[model samples]
Target: MKIGEIAKAAGVSTSRIRFYEREGIIPAAERGANGYRNYPADLIALLRFIEQAQHLGFTLREISEVETGVGEHIVSCTDALAMLAKKRDTITALIAEAQDRKRRIEALMAELEANRPAPRAAG
Candidate 1:
């Protein structure tokens, strides 16, 4: 497949695909005789995996590490699990902080509501 075809199949823009290639997130495409990029069909699956990992809050660096490890056959299930656990803990902390801020805002709103001026009596 070509870059456009791969991008369409991966649900990403052509520029994004190119950027991923430049960033080493995915392997570079083979160049055809006409100088056009030719990507393997498997590239689409790899791109989708990258998209999913990003959605799951994995940074590019983290994704790169995993990709490199997988490519080298050095990454184990336990290593992946550890990375996930760290991410989960970070997200949990962020959620707690957000909830605390929400509670504070609600409290301020209640205070403002209580102190609001009453209606004036008719003359």
Candidate 2:
């Protein structure tokens, strides 16, 4: 598939694909007639994975490192799993904290409502 087609199918722009190519995550595109870029069909999946990883809080530099196995494989599958577990735990903790906060706020609101002056009926 061509770059534009891939971008449209991926719901991304051509410049984004070019940027990813420049970043070395996606493989370089093959140039066709008149300097048009021809990307492999499989790249669409790779690009979507990149998007998903970014959404999961993986930095581009980190993703690049993970992709290239750079600096002696600092990130392993086990390590990634651990990190994800920790993130999940943190999210769960935050939910609990939010629930507590919500309870306090609700209680405070109820107290205020109970203490408020009642409306006076018109004569």
Candidate 3:
């Protein structure tokens, strides 16, 4: 399919797909005789996995490592789960910190709004 079709199917923009290709996150697309880019159907699944993993705090490099099996090997499910658990804990901590910061900002904004001077009466 064409780039537009792929972007529509993946629910992302054409620029993002192009960026992913340029970033080496995915393999280069095959070129047709007409000089058009032809991508594999399986690329959709890979793109979805990349997006979902990123939502869970995985970096592009980390996603690439897992997808390519290039990092330190995990010998068992336990080892895999241990790594996942660690990431989950880190995500939780970051969420808590973000919430605390949001509360502090809201409090400051409320105070500032409360101190705002009233508008003068119309002449």
Whose TM-score is greatest here? 1
Candidate 2 vs candidate 3, TM-score winner: 3
Q: What total of clashing residue pairs does each candidate reach?
A: 0, 0, 0
Model 1 lDDT, residue 9, Cα: 95
Better of 1 and 2 by lDDT: 1
Give me the overall lDDT of model 2: 0.77
List lDDT for all candidates, in order. Answer: 0.85, 0.77, 0.76
Q: Pick out the ten consecutive residues of candidate 3 with the lowest summed lDDT.
A: 67-76
User: What would the TM-score be for candidate 1 when compared with the true structure?
Assistant: 0.76
lDDT of 1 by residue, 40-107 (tens): 88777678767877999999888888733333233467876898899999999999999999999999
Candidate 3 ranges with C-alpha deviation above 4 Å: 68-83, 93-123
Give the per-residue lDDT of model 3 (tens digit) for 45-75: 6677667767877788877766333223312
Compose the digit string of candidate 2's lDDT tens values, residues 1-123: 888899987778899899998988777999988798998776766677667768987678756755323333334688667767876787789899999999999999999999999999999
TM-score of decoy 3: 0.61
- Candidate 2 stretches greater than 4 Å from native: 5-33, 40-42, 54-65, 68-76
